[model samples]
Target: MTFENTKEFAQQLDSQDKLNKYRDEFIFPKVNGEKVIYFTGNSLGLQPKRTKAYVDEVMDDWANLAVEGHFYAEKPWWDYHERFAKPLSKIVGALPSEVTVMNTLTVNLHLLMVSFYRPTKSRYKIICEEKAFPSDQYMFQSQVHFHGYKTEDAIVEIKRREGEHNIRLEDVLAKIAEVGDELALVLIGGVNYYTGQVFDMKTITAAGHDAGAIVGWDLAHAAGNIKLELHDWNADFAAWCSYKYMNSGPGNASGCFVHEKHHNNPDLPRFAGWWGHNKERRFKMEPTFDPVQGADGWQISNLPILSLAPYLASVEMFEEIGMDALIEKRDRITAYLEFILQEIDKEVDSTFEIITPADPSERGCQLSVLLHGEGRSLFDYLMENGVITDWREPNVIRLAPVPLYCSFEDMYDFGQILKAGILR
Candidate 1:
């Protein structure tokens, strides 16, 4: 659909959006009694109104029963952690038993590393994108160093062929072949946080598997924003945080998925904890720890219900809308945002270049715009006018218009604001 920079045209598009009503579901941040057109759901999502009610139910249950809430409440605390299974399973496209909502992003990443990244003498290496999140690079480096292996030899970093911002699928497949024999595991972020580029999980998984290596994903920025079928893709394991597009509160619970294919594979190692032990004898205080089946077997502790309440609220919305439809709207919303941004750039001196892919299917909702000429000041100018996008290091400003909360008007309005901010 072609667009022009007119308020009437923008309103008409918003009017036709089948998911238009969902904008009212979130608590929009206000600036001088005017709703701020928030487009940062890629970094953090707006809170759902039901979040309070969900938390209240858990609080009231705890208030009334205190210690016994673990066993007696309607959503028993003893089984509180398990409540996340079915809903989280749907989000990442996995079986219920293959997922669990647990520790934060980095912690889960560390735990999965301990299990999957076992470096041997002949085949003792890991492969990851060159510009991975700093935390992940550190985690990968430490894993190799702890086992008396040099980080340089034990980790293969794939760069984007010099001038590129995103990796091509063919390049990734070729890398797997080139490094296949010596590679132990391929741990990649499902989406590049800086570039807002969504990686092709199915093809990458196939390449890694064919190369005789395990493939795991860090889905920190991809989970709720993208439609994923981790099980069908045959991903060995994956982890994601809930605070972003999932609308879970800040530092809220995180989740992980382990494919059913690895459920009982004796070769797959796990870091054991009491909660991962067999439920029948978990509280029996047995000396030996027998892990449960599936991804629940990866769980380490009883859930923090207070932390999980926000996710329950968000997942209920996802269940109602169905994620497939969400992605359809997401693609439209993101494509509109990108089209408008580029169109706006055309109006200017071509000062801004998009680092994320133009293909809607290859990206989530976010657009990473690289503003030339002292970029941080340009981002500051947008923030001064209440245009709330996130800026990564150097010069990239990320704008994500979440379909669940953003409008076409929001996209155009931001485009106008950005033009005024930059061209002036």
Candidate 2:
């Protein structure tokens, strides 16, 4: 499909877009009395207008029923989280029994590692991508330290080639093989936050298992943004934050996955609490912890219902639209965004390099642009001009044209604003 840097062309694409109506479903911030063109869904998603009702339901229940809301409210607070299992399972391609909603991303990762990251005398190293998100980096450091190992020795980072922006699949596989029996766990972000590269999870998971290591994923960027088959891929465990592509509010509850094969394993270690205990026996308040089977077994405390409310609202929205529809629009709109960037670069005679992989299968909605002659001022200029985007260190601006709410018109408008910012 040929893309033109014109309002008419963008409008034509928008007219044909089945998901275009969803743009109105979200509330966008205004700059100079106009709704800003949003490009930061990869960072924080715009709130759904329906979110208020979900929250209000909880608030109303608390107001009227008091403590009894836990049992008698419309969507009873005690069983509130159970609503997410079916829909979220569909989104991440897992069985309902294999999925649950719980703590935030990094916290869940740490909790999951207690079970998946067991180290031995000879096998204690963990393999992860070089320059992982700072939180994950810190988590790895702390986890290895807790288990009494030096950070440098216990963590094996698969690095990109000097001039390359993305890590090669072969390098990752080779690293797993090289680590061999010494590898205790293979934990990587399914979608790299920096370069927007989507790793080959199925192959990597298989490789990790073959190398005698447990495999897991941090799906913060990949969860709702891409197609995932955690069950079919046979990933031991995975966790993702809902506030990004999932469109839940800030710091919302996270979704988790644990394969059914591990459900019946009573010996698997985890930090447990009353919520994770068997629901039937929970009121009994027995001294011994009998964990609820499946992903719920990993919960450490009673859920924060308010946090789960907005997430349930967003997850239901994903169920309504389905991932196939989202990915179809994602691929086309992201390509359009890339085309617009290229067109703008040509128009401005500026050197703008997209570090994200060109293959549709290797990226999601995000396109990270490396500005050769630009700096922070351009990012500031974009922000002031009603283009809400994210700027990383050096000169890269991350743009995520989220299929749910962002439009082709937004992409074209962003190009015009970008050109103006560069010229100014």
Candidate 3:
């Protein structure tokens, strides 16, 4: 699809977009009575207009039904989290039994690691990309330390070539081979938060398994942003937050995946909670723990109905629109955004450099720009003008044109606003 760097061309594209109507489904941030051009879905997505009604439904149940709501209300609170499995499984490409929504992202990561990341004296090294999200880094370090290992000795970090922003897949594969017998786990982000680079999860998972290491992914940025096949990839486990591309409310309940191969394994170690006990005897409250079958076995507590409400609101939209439609628009709009930026670069002799991969398959909706000369000042200029974008530490500015809410015209207007900022 050839793109022209003009508002008329942008409008033409918007006129034909099937997902254009979804923009109205969300409530956008406004300034001076006008909606801001939101390009920060990688950080936090806009609230869906229906989120309020969904939350209120839960509130209404509590108001009238009181304790009886647990068993008798509409959509019984006892199995509230269960409904999410099927819809979220579609979003992340896993079986309903393989997926469950429960704790927040990091907590779920720790829980999964308890069952998957079994380290020993000879094979305990964890391989990951350098400068993974702070939480991930901390989790890795703490987990290794808990097992009487030093982080420096047990962690193998994959770094890029000196001038490159993204880690090459070859380098990642080689790290698995190099670590070989000592590599106990390979845990990395599916879509890097800072670079917006979508890692090859399938290839990476295979390589890690070949090296006799358990594999997992933190799909915080990738879950709803890219096409994932966690089950097909045979990933041991994975976790993701619902706030960003999932459009669930901020710090909402997160989702997790566990392959079916691990389902009936009674020997697998986990931090058991009453909620994860076998449903037949869960109310019996026996002294011994008998775990549930699939990913539901990892759950520690009953569903947080209020926090889970927004996810229901969001996943319904995902099921309605479907991922294929979402990915199609994502590719087109992101390419147009890249084209607009390049045109702006030519027009102004721009000093900014795109740090994300040029290949569409290697990225999601985000484009991380490295401002060479004037960095934060330019970011501030756009912010003051009401162009919402993400600014990472040091120098990267990320602009994500989410397919659900961002229009092609928004990208055009951004280019114009960027040109004005550069000229000023």
Candidate 4:
């Protein structure tokens, strides 16, 4: 399909768009009394308009039922988290029994590591992508330290080639082989936060297992943005935050996956709590920690229902639209965004190089643009002009044209605003 940098062309596309009407479901912030062209869904998703009803139900339940809400409320706070299992399983490509919602992303990762990241005297090294999200970096460092190993000796980072923007899959596989018997774990972000490259998890997980190591993914950017099959891929575990493409809220609850193979393994280690105990026997208050069979076994405490409410609202939206429809719109809109960028680059004196992979299968909604002859001033200009985008250090601007809310006209209008900013 051809794209044109014109309002009429954009509007024509919008008219034909099946998902365009869903944009009204979200509440967008205004700049200068007009709705801003939001490109930060990769950071914080716009709140769904229906979110209020979900939260209000919980708040009202608490007000009316008090302690009884745990047993008698509409959602039954005691079993509220059970609601996420089915819908979230579909989103992340896992069985309902293999998935659960718990604490936050990093916290869940840490808890999961207790079960998956076991290292022995000979096999102690962990392989991860270089420059992982800062939180993961800190977690890795701390985890190895707690196990009495230096980060330098225990963590092996897969580095991108000198001029390349993304890590090569071959390189990752080769690194896994090189680490070989010493490799205890292979964990990396499924979609890199910096370059927006989607890793091949199935192949990587298989490769890690062949090397006698456990494999997992941090799906912070991939969970709702791209296709995933944690179960089919045989990933030992995975976790992701709900605040990004999932659109839960700021620092909201997280979703997790634990393969079914590990469900019956009583020897698998994890931090236990009353919530993770078997549901029927939980009220018995037995001293033994007989954990719930699947992913719920990792839960450390009772869920925060208020946090899960917004998440439940969002996942239900995903269930309604389905991932197939979302991906169809995501690819087309992202391609159109890239086309707009290239068209504007041709007209302007500045050069805009897209650092993300050109293949649709290798990227999601984000396009990280590496600017030449441009800097933070351009980013500031865009924000002031009602274009809500993200600015990385040095000279890169990240734009995520989220399919649920952003429109085609936003790409055309952003081109106009961007051109003016460059000229100014």
Candidate 5:
């Protein structure tokens, strides 16, 4: 599709967009009584208009039903998190029994590590990308430390080749093999946080398996942004927060996926809680811990109804449109954003290069642009001018054209704002 750097063209595109009507479902922030062109869904999603009603439903159940709400509320609070199984499994491309909504992302990561990252004395090394999200870095460090190993020796970080913005798949696969017998696990971000590079998870999973290693992913950015097939990929485990593309709310409950192969394995180590106990025998309060059948076995505590409510509210919309449709719109809208940025760079004398991959399959909705000279002011200029793109350290500004909320007209407005920013 040919894109024009004009509001008329953008408006025309928006007019034809199949997902355009869904934008009304969100409540956007305003600047000086005007709605800003929000492009930060990769950081925190906009509040769904229906979120309040969903939360209120839970509140109302609590208000009248009290303790009885656990079993008797319209949507029982006892199995509140269970509601996410079907929608989330569909979203992540896993079987319903393989998925469960639970604690925050990092906590789930640690829990999954407890079960999947079994580093024996002979093979205790873990391979991951350099500059992973700080939470993941910390988790890896602590987990290594807990096992009486040093981070420098036990954690193998794969850096981007010198002068390159993203790690090559070949380099990643080679590193997995190079680690060889010492490699115990391969954990990586599904979509890299800083560069928005979507890794080939299926191939990576295969490589890790061939090298005699378990594999997992921190899907914080990839979960709702890109298409994923966790089950087909045969990933050992994965975790993701709902706050970003999932648009559940700030610091919302996260979801986890575990392959069915691990479900019945009583020998697998995990931190247990009552919620993970078998429902039939949970009320018996027996001394022996009877674990649930599948991914539900990994839960460490009762579900947070309030937090999960917003997720339900957001995912219901996902259920309506479906991920295939969302991805179709995602690729086109992101391409439009990339095109606008490239056009702006051509017209401007200053240096502006996209750090994200050029191939549509290699990225999601995000485009990370590196601004060479006089860039900090330009980032500030965008923020002050009612454009809501996010800035990373050094000189990169991240803009995500979210399919469910952002429109093509907003992309045009962003290009115009960026041009003015460079000049001013």
Candidate 6:
């Protein structure tokens, strides 16, 4: 908790990091055969070394017994996905019955929207932060249009002042107040992808509920990045992809949450599949659409074991280190990075601003850097030097040294590389 300069800070912080051992579990990205400092878990997480073995277990099951693999595999590919529920539930702070791993992010979003985004005459509007992930924007538009409403009229996008990065909590509540009776659904990212701001979900959900609106969160960046208490927050529903912070590999399956109170909604119209049918009667195919309780009821397709396995492995790591230690490490490393970036800006004549919140509690691991005139060149230079960060459009570079794998030495080295690049 105490330190000198960045190097001393990093060294002392690393020494104190309870989750430091988790860094060895992953296969960091290699560029030209060198392990690059991967500060882009906001974009994609490093692959856990156990991923192959996990995949092989499923593979062996399929090879040894085709249909029998369903119930007889090593982990039993049939209920294999369910094995992840307990751990995943802990990661996102939901009950096992309220979480399910299935489908891609946008698809799951649409499915959850089907259940949660009920729009009636006087109460037919959706509230979200402006410039939400393009996928969410598209899904909202298509969902509204499908229901015979123009998206522009039905959607309200909350934005920041000129040149600002995050949407303020007060602004969010004020907008909900303005929308009042008309706001039927409030869907926003728990952590904004670009700014790395972790929205106050408890407050947001409370305000939405007070306004008589259903609240949902897109935890694409928040899940596994920060500690969440979705159930306690009384959030109506939420969904997240597993590839980035969850380390589930690219295009991995997504997870969803529907509160236990809404899980038995016999009246909620949903785009259902047989997979969403009552688990006991699923194979019977007796035809009644009895949905499983909680978030599992929102599932629409069979579990993809291959993709889900990587997530399972990562969640296993999460269970070992726990979210508390993970978040502590994350905040320290991110602060180090932010300090170094600011230091670099001080030494230079150019303008580079950190758009992410200065408070660690307000963010996850990510820091969004807004560069001025030389942003692009600085980005290219860093990339060419094997400093792996992500560039969001219009002059913002996003960096996230995930606590599970990124090293303090890694952050220090990244700072050095970044400084050298920007100074030149």
- TM-scores for all candidates: the values are 0.97, 0.99, 0.99, 0.99, 0.99, 0.96
Best by lDDT: 4
Arrange candidates, best lDDT first.
Answer: 4, 2, 3, 5, 1, 6
Q: Candidate 6, 184: how far from true, in Å?
A: 0.6
Model 2 has an lDDT value of: 0.94
lDDT (10s digit) by residue, model 5, range 28-81 = 999868899998999999999999999999899999999999999999988877
Q: Write the per-residue lDDT of candidate 4 for residues 1-424, one digit (tens) a residue.
A: 9889999999999999999999999999999999999999999999999999999999999999998999999999999999999899999999999999999999999999999999999999999999899999999999999999999999999999999999999999999999999999999999999989999999999999999999999999999999898999999999999999999999999999999999999888888999999998998999999898889878878789999999999999999999999999999999999999999999995478999999998999999999988999999999999999999989999999999999999999999999999999
Give the alpha-carbon lDDT of every model. 0.86, 0.94, 0.93, 0.95, 0.92, 0.85
Instruction: State the lDDT of candidate 6 residue by residue for 1-424, as single tens digits.
Output: 4433467667777787777777777887677788898888888888889888988887887888988988887787767778878988899999988888888888888988887888898899999998899998999999999988998899999999787778999999999999999999999999999888999999999999999999999999999989899999999888899899988898888888888888766898898887778888899986678887767767767778878788888888788777888887788878877777776677776478888999777998888888887657888998888888888788989989888888787777787887788767
Clashes of each: 0, 0, 0, 0, 0, 1
Off by more than 4 A, model 6: 6-9
RMSD (Å) of each candidate, 1 decimal: 1.4, 0.7, 0.8, 0.7, 0.8, 1.5
Give every collision pair in model 3. Answer: none
RMSD (Cα, Å) of model 5:
0.8
Comparing 2 with 5 on lDDT, the higher-scoring candidate is 2
Q: Could you tell me which residue pairs clash in candidate 6?
A: 39-400
lDDT-superior candidate, 1 or 2: 2
Off by over 4 Å in 1: none
After superposition, the stretches of candidate 4 with alpha carbons farther than 4 Å from their true spots are none
Sliding window of 10 residues with minimal summed lDDT for model 2:
293-302
**Per-residue CA lDDT of candidate 1, range 293-388, in tens?**
877787788778899888988987888888888888888878888778878878886888899988877899788888777478888888777778
In candidate 4, residue 148 scores what lDDT? 96
Cα displacement (Å) at residue 137, model 4: 0.4
